[model samples]
Target chain A: MTAYALLVEYDGAGLVGWQRQSNGLSVQEAIETAATSLNGGATPLATAAGRTDAGVHAEGQVVHLDLAADLPPARLRAALDFHLRPQRIAIRAACLAPEGWSPRFSAARRHYRFRILNRPAKPALEEGRVWHVPLPLDAAAMHDAAQALLGKHDFSAFRAASCQAEHAIRTLDRLDVTRVGEEVVIHASARSFLHHQIRNLAGTLHMVGLGRRPVSWPRELLEGRDRRRAGQTAPPEGLVFLGVDYDPPLPWVTSDRA
Target chain B: MTAYALLVEYDGAGLVGWQRQSNGLSVQEAIETAATSLNGGATPLATAAGRTDAGVHAEGQVVHLDLAADLPPARLRAALDFHLRPQRIAIRAACLAPEGWSPRFSAARRHYRFRILNRPAKPALEEGRVWHVPLPLDAAAMHDAAQALLGKHDFSAFRAASCQAEHAIRTLDRLDVTRVGEEVVIHASARSFLHHQIRNLAGTLHMVGLGRRPVSWPRELLEGRDRRRAGQTAPPEGLVFLGVDYDPPLPWVTSDRA
Candidate 1:
């Protein structure tokens, strides 16, 4: 069997997100079904770098799977894309990976972005792609408050109650808040994240941006280690899994295999 | 009655065109209904600078309406926005206009933009906002061919059959094509246009971009003045009415009325 990595993009509006669930269709189930068809009815398990929640989009989600069929990466990508049509998903790129490479564990960093439409009028063009906050937000204040959460710390205050991680300690590489025209943008990067961590952070920062919380509130929440003390979790629609980075980065295969 | 001007934005996915129609709900009818609610049940007429076709979006569509209620511009704007809730439309701005001002007649220029997703994948997030063209396109070739239709001409070749314009002669001010990442953007400007003129021009230019037709084909179509020989009229989903410009410039009232 050959191991392959696929770069995928999807609109998470209607799907049940990145994991396989009994409630509805999921990104994982859809892709595995398409791959199973190409593999002559044998199901191949596809593992993603991030199991994003429902209504959370992805621009460059990475997935890995093993296939018995020895097909060129380009043809595989094209075929998978064809089978995935009429759905809001695309296989952007596919490549052969080094043996035993894992998309979930081989990553060094993961990036995410959250968008807030900071305007009085509701969005017409970007309705579901953004969090509509009718009140004005101070981006600079939010940026200042976000700096308090950097580096290794116990992020229990921001962790979801259902998170499966063993510990709440994680290193946040970056957290930035900025305003571009009428939208407030938040970018975050880390080695990994707990369930609803980024969304919780965004919600807390939103309070600081609105002047309801002091600049030191995020730091206080971290010290308190109480999830209830943190702000409400931001909606999943505004969150996007940007991409992932790997140490000794996987050599992307661009040309067709002979 | 006080004459007022409004800057409006809307998503045209489910609504009819700007004009009132018996078949479906129109943008004009929606705004008029909201305005009439503020004017004590008397339906006010809303005239738009550009009567965009069905599924055509607008970012800054200029509109004029007269109301019997002497309300502040801010209050009027807020009331209309409140009543337009759950609808994919917004009143971006409102101001008192000079008496006798007409959105359709006093306009000096109209601006429009068309978006094409030039990629192999169908859009997930921007599904209805852009035209998905899977083939690779040469933006430079398209831009070069568009220059042929810049000057004044009798554009019978590009005019739609149902167009009610008295004359086919119109001056084209701008037609620019540029590639932005995976999308090809086309911007067109003119004092006025015949029905489906821009879409037809886009369709013709698309052929030139694909090397299906020579760069000189647009000029040849213009000279021939035969509508049947030109390319098909492009879909309305990709077209956007950006805004309009007034010659003397309408003085926008900023302060709230006493």
Candidate 2:
């Protein structure tokens, strides 16, 4: 058996998140089905660094799966991409994995970007890819408020009720908010995230950006540790899984076969 | 009667071209229908600066129309936008046009951008918004070759066969190509263009970027003055009408009611 890692990108619209469920089609099921076809009837389980929710897009998602056939990385990637055709998914690259490497548990950080179209008119070009807020937002104030949530803390106030994680304690390495033209962009990085943590944070910061809450609001919510007191969870359409960073770095593989 | 100008933005995925046609829904038809309803059954003809082809997007298209009702600019804009819902079009701003103003005739320059996704993987998020080219391209080479087509010249080589322009001579103001990460971006500007000129130039420059043609090939094609000698017309999906420039600048109007 050969362990391989694949870099994936997908549009999460109309998808049932990353996990396989009987409810609807999923990113995991789609990739696994394609990989199984290539493995000639043997099903291979694929594990990703993050199991993104439905309507959440990804630019650089990492996945690991073991295949019985030891095909060249380029050939396997091309074949898998071919089978996954007509679906909104692409295998950016594939490479032989280091022995015992895990895409989910490998020691490193993950990054996400949340986009908000802060304009009066509804989005045309960026529909389904951004959270449209007709009201003007103060990005600088949001960035100031986001600073209070950085570092280690019990983020229970921002954790989803359905989150299965045992503990709400996590370290947030970065949270930045900036305006790029009509879009308010927020970048967040951490070792891992509890379910809906970024969305919750984005929602809470939005209130601050709109001047509905003071800059001290996020810190107060963190200390209170009450989920109901926090703002509404921002919609999933705006969140994107940017990429993952692995410690000691995995071998960089080129998609070019030549 | 009020002569009004609207700044428009739209996603060109489903609509026909800007012109009104009997076969399919066009951007012009969508706006006109909405405006006519607001005008109480009287149809208002809309004229745009550029007649963008089907599947071509626009960031800042200027349009002029005359309405019988003399409503406030912001209220009129809001009403039009409210009626334009469920369609992939937005009225960015609306204002009273100066007397005798024409969107097409009074334009000083027009800007367009073409995007090429230079990567091995097919696009997932940007699928229909960019042209995917699997082969590696040298953006610098493309830019270098494009410099030869600058200034006034007979550009019959790049004009489409069906182009109805009386003369093939046009003064090209700017044609620049640059690489942005995994995408190659080309920006072009001119007072006017012959049909399919930018696409043809892009396709020809693509050959130079691929090292398939010498850097001097664009100049040779231009001097040859043969439409058949030029490269294929790049697809419409990759092109965007950036905006139009009017000299003696029109008054800037804000969409905000306050």
Candidate 3:
């Protein structure tokens, strides 16, 4: 059996997160079913870099699975995407992972993007895809305040109540906020994140953007390490799992084994 | 009665074109109903700069209506958007138009954008928003071919079968094609266009991009002035009404009556 990593993309609307759930469809189930179909009904276990919540989107999500049958990278992607029909999921690329490389672990960093449509009127073209904050937001102010939470720190204040992480200490590599046209985009990167950490950070910084809280407020919340002291968790619709990065970039050469 | 112009935007996934149709809901009917609700049950006629086909989106559509009850520009926008409820249409801006101004006839130029997802994988995040062309596209080649259609011309070759234009003579102000990441964006501008003219132009240019036809093919088709000689009309989903341009730009100063 050979382990292969698949670059994935999906629209998370109407999905029950990335993991399989009894209530509704998940991105993982769709991919696994497709992989199984490709292998003639042998179920495959697909693991992802991030298990995102429902209503979240992914432009460059990464996943891995062990295949009993060896196929070329292009053929694997084409066959997988063919069976993943009707679902808003795509297998962008398929390549061999270095021996035991796991999408969940053995990774360097994860990147996320949160979009906010700041305007007096609600979004029409980007309704469900963006968080419509109908008030004028100061993006520059929000960017300045986000710096307070950068670097290694205990992010207990931003942790979700249902978080299962062993510890609250994690390093936030980047938090950038910028205005593009009528939208304010927030980009967050880290090695790994506590549940709802990015959403909570976005929510807290939003207060500063709206001039409701001072720039020092998020710092105080971080130092306090109390979830209640932080602002509300931003909605899931606006957040997108951009992708994951590994220390040594995974090499890609078309396998001769078709 | 005072004439007010509105800058509108909408996601046209389920809309039945801009004009009111007996078959399904239309952007015009929605806006008119909203206007009637604001006027306490008097239907107001709404005229758009362009009457787009079904499934055509708009980022900056312009419309105008004569209101019996005058309100401030901001208030007018807010009230209409409130009444327009639940629909995926947004009144981006509302302001007074010069007396007797009509959105259709008073416009100097109309701008449109066509989006093509030129990739092997189908779209996930932008499913219904773009035309997915699986083959690799040569954007530079397409742009070179598009220059053949710029300036004044008899566009009968690109006109729709159902087009009601009295004459086929029209001025083509600009046509630009550029690659943005994996997407090829085509921008077209003119004082006006025949029904499906831009879509046909895009379709013809697409052949050039794919190397199926030479760059000189579109110019030859233009010289022919026969609709059958042009390529197929591009899908409606990829088209967007960017906005309308008016000479001596419409004044937006608040009226004293409002």
Best by TM-score: 2
Residue B166, candidate 1: Cα error in Å is 2.4
**Cα lDDT, all candidates:** 0.90, 0.91, 0.89
List ranges where model 3 is wrong by over 4 Å: A251-258, B251-258
Point out the worst 10-residue segment of candidate 1 chain A by lDDT.
Answer: A249-258
**How would you order the candidates by DockQ, starting with the best?**
2, 3, 1
For candidate 3, what is the interface RMSD?
Answer: 3.7
| Candidate 3 lDDT, B1-258, residue by residue in tens | 778999899989999999999999999999999998667589999999999999999988999988888787778888888777799998888888876778899899999999999877778888889998988889999999999889889999999989999999999988999999879999999999999999999999999999999999999999999999889899999999999988768654322232
Ranking by TM-score: 2, 3, 1
| Per-candidate DockQ vs. reference | 0.45, 0.71, 0.52
- Kindly list the per-residue Cα lDDT of model 3 for residues A75-193, writing each as its tens digit: 88878877887999987777888876888788799999999998767789998789888777899999988988899999999999999999999999999999998899999999999
Look at candidate 1 and tell me the lDDT of residue A110: 97
**lDDT top scorer:** 2
Give the C-alpha miss distance for residue A91 in model 3, angstroms.
1.4
Predicted candidate 1 versus true structure: per-residue lDDT over B221-245, tens digit per residue: 9999999999978889999999899
CAPRI-style grade of the A/B interface in model 3: medium
On DockQ, the stronger of 1 and 3 is 3
RMSD of each: 2.7, 1.2, 2.5
Q: Write the per-residue lDDT of candidate 1 for residues A107-197, one digit (tens) a residue.
A: 8999999999887777877888899887889999999999999999999999999999999999999999999988999999999999999
